[model samples]
Target: MENSIYQVYEDEIQSLEEEIKMLAEKYEDSQQESTFFSDEEILMSMKSFQTEFQGELKGQESPSDLKAQLESLEADLSFLMKFTGIWFTSHSKKTVEKTGSRTIQKHRLSGNCHSLPFQLEFQLLEIKSKESVSAVITDLNVIMESGEYSGVSKFVSSTEEHGNLLPFFKSLSSYAEWYEHRRCTFLHFKTRYPDIVKLPEGLLGDYIVLRNPEPSGFELMIVWKIHVDEDGRTTPVLDLLTKVPEQVLEQNITTIENAPTCFRSMLLLFGIETAIENLIKVVGLKK
Candidate 1:
């Protein structure tokens, strides 16, 4: 009976080892893909696994033996989770200057891909109890630049709803990653065909003005609008403007079908591949 019990424990451990190895390999493979599991999901899974393992080992092995095995597994899990592409896993936390009797904690996560860089910040108000704590996404900015085409886009959460910091952090981190991926794709295209593709210039506020090469002295303006629903879901709306009244009258300034090939390609980089369709649907643009 003693030998059989030991064999069972050994078999369970071996099975867990195999599972961990498979997860690690999947994590590695996902890095090269466009879509992968979010960091929050992966971390939560690791935590759940840890809890289950602890419960399974309790009363099954000597206290010392359980502690040693738990520590080993935890260390391995931590290492794996760090490389799972979650920005929060590598975030930095610092205490900001106190305001009156309230203390503030600032956590920041930042990353860049080539010329595109992004930063997400969370400001937490520390209280006496964890339940009284509150956090908000203070800043979310992504800057993309290639030659004369450079713009800084910022994300603003509409509602002032404050709650646990973990969910907010996860959402912002995921947004930053998505922004980076979109920027990287845009940069790749811009780099490959520099002469053919030119970035819009004179970007001010939420609008970009591009000098139309074909029409000589004509400029195309692109406007950006972000809509945040009650549920905190964000949708991007794009609009186009032109100084020439005749183009508007003709209803053919820059329809998706009639847009410059390079311009159309650049719009795909903005995380809105169907920008023209969105502009038409949302803004009621004809043609």
Candidate 2:
């Protein structure tokens, strides 16, 4: 039949999309697994910094020469991303040196946390004495897409309080990882069951509705959310919601009412993907 042939093409296209998505996810995971720069690039940048610092210590160059060297060093450092899943592509800095061998610098850093982009603006005041160097960060600010960072206001507040960006980057990376997983999961199901799965908010949504292929079955919804705590811990939360007609509920009140609870139990027994697959099967769908 013409309908059957069309479905065959659709299924093939879905298969190709899944393959591409798999390759993309692998690339992203590799990026998270390794630093942006190779070992050689990092070593070169570090050695360059050493050379610049040594030149500064020589005390033989003019102030202009020192400034030029420092500027060069900063530029080099800006390109080298040494942290895993965290890298600054560009930055701006203003440095002030005091008579007591102390220096104060203000830095504005623009970077990405894995695939999630963020811009960090902060002032770093570094004080150098004969024996030691001390640093303080102030006027901390973060700019990110408001939608991407909806639930993590407390994380920002805590990061500002502690003047630490490491925790924030780590949390952001983990959160983004979970976020991608949810997105891809929804996409996979929506594509696989195009007639049965409906997304109210497109692919970026937090939930998917699974309708029965036949008219006799009730509708099931899966809600997936990624949670980030103040301590930089990330968790994925999933729940099931259902809507059944009055006739169906009257015929099977216990099953209709207990679907959510049963789903939670299934989630505990089996993982999320498996639980979702089982739930779909239970909805009287062929797949």
Highest-scoring model, TM-score: 2
Candidate 2 per-residue lDDT over residues 213-246, each given as its tens digit: 7777689889887777889898887899888877
The local distance difference test score of each candidate is: 0.47, 0.76
- Compared with the true structure, what per-residue lDDT tens digits does model 1 show for residues 91-194? 56565645433556566666542223444566666554446654344433322232222221222232223432344344344544544544553354346434
Give per-candidate clash totals.
Answer: 0, 0
* Most lDDT-accurate candidate: 2
| Ten-residue region with minimum lDDT total, candidate 1 | 146-155
- Score every model by TM-score: 0.35, 0.66
Model 1 misplaced stretches (Cα beyond 4 Å) = 1-84, 88-161, 192-197, 200-210, 215-217, 224-230, 245-271, 274-287
TM-score quality measure for candidate 1: 0.35
- Where does model 2 exceed 4 Å of error? 1-83, 96-101, 129-133
Question: How many residue-pair clashes does candidate 1 contain?
Answer: 0
